[model samples]
Target: MRDENEMEELESVVERMQQGDRAAYEVLLDRFQPSVFRLAHRVTGSREDAWDVVQEVFLCVHRRREELREASRFRPWLYRMAYCQAVDVVRLRSGKRVDAWGDGEEAHAAAPEAGPSARAETNALADEMNRALSALPEKFREPLVLATHGKLSYEEIAGTVGCPVGTVRSRISAARQLLKERLSAWLGND
Candidate 1:
């Protein structure tokens, strides 16, 4: 369920956006930029590519603002757009299928603030997690990222990925199991 305040705000933005208000579009961009970047980064596995995706997504949103009927559905709709754009970027760069996998270097580079030993451990774990997530097929990776990183409901994920709810559920479950198996080995549990 959407919060009343957020819903109201979104409605206002949508209304203004539909009126060709650039400021309103800017507001929407500001609100969604970080999430858009994160989703793009996760999908494309390149910060530069992610930035390009963000710009293209907002441009597409602005161009198609009138197609949006309900402000409440904007989150999932926007995610769908972002996902598509990121996939396109990946395809264009690779000239092949979309390979949704990170190199693990980016994950290791952005260490959280902590003591040296703790930070080192955290970096190692993060790199391992990135590698595990990268190994997942796009079908599994998309839903897992939407559910966990995007904080979307199963239904929302289904809508974003154009899959059934049960499929989304299964993919996420399978992805989690794969990650657990991979990480367990890294953690010396296997």
Candidate 2:
């Protein structure tokens, strides 16, 4: 999931955290909060809920830090907690599934220099993409979001979602195909 240097940094941080270093825990929080929020937001489709999930994840990590046997396993362990917490929040909150991908702020912010027409086009495309993502089944959507937004590998996704690596690959592939089918018009495939 992370590059070698990043993984090394994570391992060092995790080792310090295992030793009850509060500063190391802070480092972990600072390093992973955004990506964790992104994964939670994509899976839960609510910024508020995602924030809740992120808080719960870090809390759990801090409480159960000793349960982690390997420093190398910290990343996926954190992500698994995030994935589970987000799903639990969705289940508790009226059983409504994740219906939107994100608020499109990131998409808009990424292209702030664009002309008005270009911004409108970007917004339109973002809307279409969100719709396509929302239409996917949860089984497919979860793995895809974990891979794309969480930046996790298939093995990591499999571990987080509690499935085999092959199943994760299939779900991600199927999700992409579904998205392609849904956005064919925007993609100029018509």
Candidate 3:
């Protein structure tokens, strides 16, 4: 219900987009860039990689605007594209086809960058949280980020991930459990 306003705004942009309004797409980009980059950042675990992932995401979305059926779910749809784009970037870098069930660590999902900071304790905790997230399997990481940070619903996540709604719920539940166990201090209320 709340997202209606967001959808309405995006719909206007998408309509203009459909009418070949390049400017409208730019507006859309401005609106969603923060969330898109965050999703990319989580997936790639690097600011630079995330930036590249976002550019790819927008390009892919722009190319596929004709295929969008649910503007109300624009945010999730955008996220799915960002997710796939991140995966693609990682695969291209590694020069291998991504097997979803790949061994462990997935390496590229390594911790996001953090340098010497004025607040060492906070920096250390942030680094630890990222490491905990990095240790998670990709299946869990994507669902958790998309659901918790992306603020996507189970149904919307199901659509984005091309999975059943129940599966989305189960995956998010499993991810939450893992985070609770591994990042108890950072997460709090374990």
Candidate 4:
């Protein structure tokens, strides 16, 4: 969570961007691009699609900079745009064959010393987890991803998803329950 000072700084940056400050826009991009990509990836379940979404999102931000009336609300507004853009990509590419999980490059990087068997097991588990997540209904999946990967608060997610905070809470809880049920075998609960 950002402190009060950080939020104020972001608000100032957003205001500057709205006022045509290119430097402020660059700062926003540098700070937010990675998170936007991760959020897009989790939503669309395709790295390529995520990249596409990120491009579209920043473009939208640049074009629609003046649409943001309250600078303090920039984060959720930006997330909403990214989320909607990712949903569009998913809808457009629904039938295309793409990797449902990202390449396990990050996982491999984290455990470079692991033996071959360990890596294989890790990859298998990650594949299963990804499959389970993909199986979730979009309503549940979106909020869960926003919370876990995007690291948005319930209120922030509510604003991004245009839902009540209580609904966001319920959806995230339901998503966790569903994932647990789907992965019960791997969890040794079967």
Can you list the residue pairs that collide in candidate 1? none
- Separately for all candidates shown, the number of backbone clashes (residues 3 or more apart, or on different chains) is 0, 0, 0, 0
Could you give me the TM-score of model 1 versus the true structure? 0.77
Q: Write the per-residue lDDT of candidate 4 for residues 132-173, one digit (tens) a residue.
A: 988899899888878887778999999888899999999999
Instruction: Please provide, for model 3 over 13-39, each residue's C-alpha lDDT reduced to its tens digit, 9 standing for 90 to 100.
Output: 878876779999899889889988777
Write down the TM-score of every candidate. Answer: 0.77, 0.78, 0.71, 0.88
What is the Cα-based lDDT of residue 89 in candidate 3?
Answer: 77
Model 4 TM = 0.88
RMSD of each: 4.0, 3.4, 7.1, 2.3
What are the per-residue Cα lDDT tens digits for candidate 2 across 71-118?
998888888788878878877885554644676677778888888899
The Cα error of candidate 4 at residue 50, in Å, is 2.7
- Provide the global lDDT of candidate 3 against the true structure: 0.72
lDDT of each: 0.81, 0.86, 0.72, 0.87
Model 2, residue 81: distance off in Å is: 1.4
Higher-ranked by lDDT: 2 or 3: 2
- Name model 3 segments beyond 4 Å from true: 91-124, 184-190
Q: Candidate 4, which ten residues in sequence have the lowest lDDT sum?
A: 95-104
Residue 30's lDDT in candidate 1 = 96
- For candidate 1, write residues 147-181 as lDDT tens digits: 77577889889987888999999999999899999
